[model samples]
Target: MQREPQVVEAKQQGGSKYRYRILAMLFVATTINYMDRSIIGVLGPTLIEHVFHWTKMEYAQINMVFKFAYALGMLGMGGVIDRFGTRIGYILAIGIWSVFGMLHALVQPAFGFIGFCMARAGLGFGEAGNFPAAVKTVAEWYPKKDRAFATGIFNAGSNIGAILAPLAIPLVVLPDGTNWQFAFLMTGAFSFIWVLVWIKIYKKPEEHPKVSQEELAYIQSDVEEGEIEQEKEKMSWAKVLPLKQTWAFAIGKITDAVWWFYLFWGSLFLHDQFGLDLHGLALPMIIVFLIADVGSIAGGYLPKIFLNRGASLNVARKLTLLICALFILPAMFVPYMSNQWYAVLLMAFAAGGHQAWSANLFTVASDTMPKKATASVVGIGGMIGALAGMLADFSLGSVLTASGKEGYVFAFAIAGSIYLVCLALIHLIIPKLERAKI
Candidate 1:
């Protein structure tokens, strides 16, 4: 039998802070990922109304294509990352997505709808790799106690990306909406710069010369139960998919559809319901995502507090998720608010709560599975979440086509309440959050 590597005792002064440098890279990558994906959400009303002249159903179809590709990519990319490791996997994933993201500029009005779908499909397939890679990176670099906070820190990039889109896209998209291609082209360019930086900086903790022995020991200190040997063995979808912990993670991800709704449809909902123009949409969307950034970081911190106070891993994670669920309850009232900012505040809470919930939810997979299998589990859950979002897109398209603004009531209701149901199912499935045998 192979002997486990010995962990060096960390000094009282603390070890090198190299893990944070790795985390910063993850944060930037996720920020660019979200910005590229969010360009459409920020530009949705303009593209639908002025440029593409797409019907609501046609617009939904475009989003559905992205979600479909994302779902499939989650299945494949997770396995690919596990096979190849994060450095190469991340480069391939981002390169494909970035090139395809820039391709959105080439879409013209003749067969524009189909063109948009094709572009979105490529973009979605590439974007699907972001979370799997990021989560796996966190699992590799952080101890179990610190994983949620690190995940939250990086995941907040989604909100930063969301916030930046509204502020920046408007500057690039001409007031008449004629220069929308520049919006895609400019945002897509950011990833290439990020890729260059990432190539120079990233390496595994054990392999990187810059990582101190103490930091490496600190990182390896809290190996999960059964994970020592398991980490050396290869994992597959067949090995992971049968575990109840996998379902708990996947079931919890049903809320991902709610998040996608907020990402893809939130702008359109604001436009149709409140008569907001492109400039008008920026502030509310920015505020919503800003609050979400707060939630992501704070939510990740909550579980650490619980852990420090002597809570079990299961308790800390689940309780944080429960609080997040309650925060989303107010979102059901959003569509009924007479004041626009009132609706924005309510949606902000929902967005923030989801980000917080997401931070913990991502941690759960790492908590229960071996480091080797973390990306695969995240991918499986992401695929299921994307499938749920696709269904919501199809359903909401029909609802909006028939009922117009009133359809938002149904959509908000589902978004606000689904978290509780998902949490309940998660508890039933994996009450103890036991480590997987595989």
Candidate 2:
């Protein structure tokens, strides 16, 4: 006998599996975000130092510009996202960053060093919206139990972008015998294409025409109806800043500089330490980020696994963080290692540990804060993290100029120890995983 129309609709609603499709979109946007951002670091040794005859300090100053603007942008864009909603905020962000990414090609010697600084600032400003939008989207689409895994899946795109840049840039610049301009232009174009797809397809679970009732129920399964309605109300920074949960998240993020150092300086470290040119840098870069990719996905999933096994969210999350922190301890010895590959191996674990740590750290924002306030909380934390990166860039630049290879020892030591300290602070501020009162 044929099923009734109501029964068929019910079955279809229950069977619908469309959230992954949106997660895939978030993953792609993150991939493009990192690709555009990392291109400068990948090409800095060849283009900035050798081709343009820029000094290390000058290069660092340029990075300072990017970090400074990124810090401010995080603060501003966080609010923008919370106010405007993800669909509009995300498109505007990618569009702005893509234009600035392409504008790198137009920066000429005649326009002077300040011209490049301007471009970097613009890029940083636009790219700031990425995480706020992504985390908000995750918070919107997935229930709490699945959030860490979902975040980990999309967060791995950073490693993918980091991975792709080394692979793709070699093809873009080397094949033409150093048309670095082509690289910026090529990577920048990706975001433009992504924006079109996002516009056509993205909508909230409740609002999307294609989302079935069963899927919507699954999405809302973990959230209380009271919280769901309240999440739509606006939350101001004044209201959010007072919460211990906010401080715990922000304090933990202060160590974010350690990861930023790995991205911005790892290539330079290889060039200076091992006498490896750009081509030789690719394999090690690939190794570091590939492991990071594994770490990102695994780190996010581990918490879910622990939750399934009956561990408390706090215990599972913090236990994973402790393990990640221990894994990074070997990085302190990277500058002292005799063999290049040994150093490479150690840095790989450290980079991987950071990615794992980051995936969980991002989830904390959504896990504790009200959905309406998630982006704002993330913005504040990101601003703190960006400030730490700014300090690293300036200090590391000076140390490198003054001490050459020996300077990296201090950086490595700091990177190795930062997480333990930050983790301790997090535990102190928020003894439990209770959600924020907001």
Candidate 3:
């Protein structure tokens, strides 16, 4: 009661320390969330040998089913997160996906292929909620200005999960080489640990007693002018959907799919090219992906460097993302490589570069949207991205596979170039990096 300004000042000085801890649980949740999804990619060859006797076309169809379901699911989940709060929506998402992840191992009948597809669909459906919920949570918990780095940290979870899979999936195998079941089960079960961590640790700014008033004030300081607008904007969905914020998110997400395409198909590309057996080429590629993990965290830190140089947030974010996107172009050379190690160097860095781009792109979505509607916008874009990814997958097996090795090189080139095209489209759609004028 002494003075309102003094209260805010005191809290700001102390409260900044707590933000990382608050975000740490979200980081782990994202890690486990993606870990569950990626297990299949790593276990693909084993699953074919042990479980379903899948033909190539049949396997493609199986993926198509999951993609279709996941696309629809993403559309629905984003809207739901808009209406509901982040915590509850996130819990529901993780709950269903994790359960199905384990169930992938339990299904029987060699011809019960549809059941496996359905389970994959369930995993896709559940995971659809991940980004929308996570983006929303970031929008809710962090001020607008700080979101990019935070988003980068959470998005890096994909890399972390992908990195771990080579070791984890192989470790749980049976001697006879039939035990892909334990890999799925163990990965799925890992999500529950994050659930416990998230439930205990997460809360809104005002709701957390440990969050001092000063800290909240500083957290809100850059965003103080919009706190009322951000809070008021949360009232409903219709008002939020009509603005440029919607497009900003959609474009960024569509671009995001390009990276996912690289990750989902990368090892397969190696296997296809090198006649990779699990122990040789695939292991090296996994090591490469694991090595790429550094780029995720590094991507976020780049803009902070710009900020120290006194660039505005808007300027710093765009410059950093554009630079990251540009790094992807060199990746087109992978298919041309006669040497496998050179191929590894090119592809891993390119994928890592994409993560760096991805880490900043999400910040752009938050940069352009008010907190209230961030989930819906992210959902729509992510939905489109996933759908586009499905098409890309089809193209990979069908079009890219046709030319043999050169086709593969061209495929990597196409993949590399997508981010810059995405960035150009982003510039056309909403040139300035600010919240939309709606």
Runs of candidate 3 with Cα error greater than 4 angstroms are 1-13, 49-51, 174-177, 224-242, 400-407
For candidate 1, write residues 214-269 as lDDT tens digits.
Answer: 77777877775556556667788999999999999999998999999999999998
Off by over 4 Å in 2: 1-14, 110-112, 175-177
lDDT of 2 by residue, 1-438 (tens): 233434544665656778899999999999999989988888877865655666778888888899888889888889989988999999988998999989998877666378779999999999999999999999999888788899999999999999998888887687223687887887666787899899999988889888887777777776765887887788788999999999899988887898888888899898888977778888899899999999999999989888888999898889888988998888999999888899889999999999899989988888889899999999999989999998998999899889887889999999999999999999998878888886
Q: Write the per-residue lDDT of candidate 3 for residues 276-359, one digit (tens) a residue.
A: 644554466576666567677788778978986889877798788788888878887788787878888887888778778877
**Full-model lDDT for every candidate:** 0.91, 0.87, 0.71
lDDT of 1: 0.91
Q: Against the hidden true structure, what lDDT does model 3 obtain?
A: 0.71
Ranking 1 against 2 by lDDT, winner: 1
Best candidate, lDDT-wise? 1
